[model samples]
Target: MKTFCGILWEGVRKELQMSFSAFFRLLLGALKSFLNAETLQCQVFTSDEENGQLESRFISLVSNDDHKFTCNKKILSSKSDVFKTLFAGSENDQCVRFQEIEKNLIKIDDVDGETLREILRYVYFDVVDQNIMDPNPNLPFKCLLAAEKYMLDQKFKDSCQDFLVLSVDDENAFDYFRLAENLNAEQLKLSVGDYISQYLTHKRDVLP
Candidate 1:
């Protein structure tokens, strides 16, 4: 009976030891995973900080109305050939420096404050807000002109052209046709011609 009890006790002890050993191994693996995740997160954060520093370099612009705007230099240069040339000039000029708090001051004499603001919004966010344009029918035209002057992407000009095409009516068709001609927008000119032809046909049909 004593020998049997000793054997049973010894077996239980071994089982408990194995259980504890397995539990500790699992715990250690979990701890290692947690530490590795933390390290990866830290590395990502550091990389983001570095990129943020590069993106924060800015330049100052003054509109014809004297409204001032601060813009990201990299974004402006990357988006527009005109801005790229302007900033490239700054490299040779002593007046503009990336490290300077005053930044490179550019004067845009053709574009007014409000129009320039919209242009910058498109430059940064790639959007033209229609809510603002709806109340002022001339806003899209102004933005279109600015887009051309600044040498913005053709996609942006297309957005403005689309808005203008939608806003066309009997009252503004002639003016819009002239605008399309000046911009050399074949699509808009064609659309205006079609609208005018249909309108004149309908008017003739209803006449006494």
Candidate 2:
């Protein structure tokens, strides 16, 4: 009788183990099916029209000529002190009353379309080719104005200064010096003076 009772208990425990094993298998199968369904339901938004959906999170900048640009608020605020301060009061902010204010956009009256485009691209990706300084001679000045307007980082301002210095010639050297003085760019002012002095020395040496 003891042997039979022991055998019965063993059968009960085996059944319980098998039941739990089946239950867990079913649960895992259901979870995988749900995940597959969710994956199938998700859609990719890679096109230009799909970018408009980000308006709720992005800041809308409207140019004077009615050109519109959208930028990531977090990126701008992180990179620019001007944007950081503007967005700081957002919690109790009366100026930006609408949480999703596509209608109430930022007005960019001073910066031209092309300069603003380059600035926005730089803000997004932190890249601008130095080669552009030669073909577009006035680009540095435009960039300076945009940088000052945005109150951007020292790196960006310095990059613009470096470009101006590299592109400066006797014809544009005095103009750059004046621009440096106006913008308080000491690096560029010194660069201008050095470039002119070097040019004068070169001319004197080359004289027959």
Candidate 3:
């Protein structure tokens, strides 16, 4: 009887120890991932020009101005699904984007250099200041596109959502609504609808 009790206790103790160890490991893994995602939360904004370019799995981007620059491939792939899929097929081979370049140089099409630089900065750092946005209202639209393309905005939660809603107005409210639909942002869609409804109602009341 004494021997059986001792063995039973030992087994229970071992099982509890294993469970605790596994739980601790899982907790650490989750914390690491959350920290990585939230690294730039509320940090002071910086531009690509001020901090210089980040170096991580570098890729070449040729802007519309015919200028060339290097960007961090890991950061781009992590932030943008478009980039990830672009590079996905070349797992066993060199990056497909680079191979397409005549001199083993890759270039992102359509987007200009300045715009790409701003997007990259947003990826590594955070949002550009309100001052930057004031002059170029379309800035947020581009950022929203990149965020949606990479499924990144989902990770940041309300930050992107609030920014989109705040930036909406009579001129761009519909644009935000369309973007919200594309991004599956149900909350923003509802918010955009509310804004449009109010605007139309106000306009109708003031008509001659």
Candidate 4:
């Protein structure tokens, strides 16, 4: 002979216990999923880092003269946008392996061996030798062309422009002005124009 209130209390208690049990189970399942996802992500990252260390860190560059040069991939890519683009692979691609690097050699058909050597020297040591510069007056122009092609640092191009400006004279003023215009060198072009104007003024002043 249980009362109606007693029967109702029993039903409510049972329902509350069942609800709590279900909630705890759902929480546990979600936590397990989160932990498993974290572990998988960590494993993938570790694999990529280890594989990168084992791969080739250097790349080969071939000049027009058939001379091959080996450069550190990280160093070259950091300095030049062209190298960075060349080194970067597709989004779905994996890390570059040693065999793949060996098979792919970057070619610079417009630059010769000697010019390439100088470029490499500057890339490595950040210093251009005086002997090299003095002996070859045209080296700056050649380097400027290579710098433009490879998208080297602006400081290097400016240095080349400065050297060319110092070498400008009456005989080569027009030629240098044309080269400056072709290369989009504003400072060099203005300097050459000024020099040509002065030369013309001096000649007019001394006219017979």
**Candidate 1 segments exceeding 4 Å error:** 1-56, 90-103
Best by lDDT: 1
Query: Residue 73 deviation, candidate 4, in Å?
Result: 1.4
Pairs with backbone N, CA or C atoms under 3 Å apart (clashes), candidate 2: none
| Candidate 3 Cα misplacement greater than 4 A, ranges | 1-56, 88-99, 126-128, 150-161, 204-208
Q: What is the C-alpha local distance difference test score of each model? A: 0.76, 0.73, 0.65, 0.74
Q: What lDDT does candidate 1 reach at residue 62? A: 84
The true-structure Cα RMSD of candidate 1 reads: 11.8
* lDDT tens readout by residue for model 3, 140-184: 566656456445645443455666787788998888888888877
Worst 10 residues of 2 by lDDT: 92-101
Q: Relative to the unseen true structure, what is the C-alpha lDDT of residue 83 in candidate 3, on a scale of 0 to 100?
A: 70
Specify the highest-TM-score model's number: 1
Ranking by TM-score: 1, 4, 2, 3
lDDT of 4: 0.74
Predicted candidate 2 versus true structure: per-residue lDDT over 1-208, tens digit per residue: 5698899999999999999999999999998865433222333568867655544446677665667776667677777776777767545343342233355377777766767777776786787766656668788779887787677887888888988877788798888888888888888988998888898899999999
How would you encode candidate 4's per-residue C-alpha lDDT over 113-139 as one tens digit per residue? 888888877776676655556777888
Return the TM-score for each candidate structure.
0.64, 0.62, 0.55, 0.64
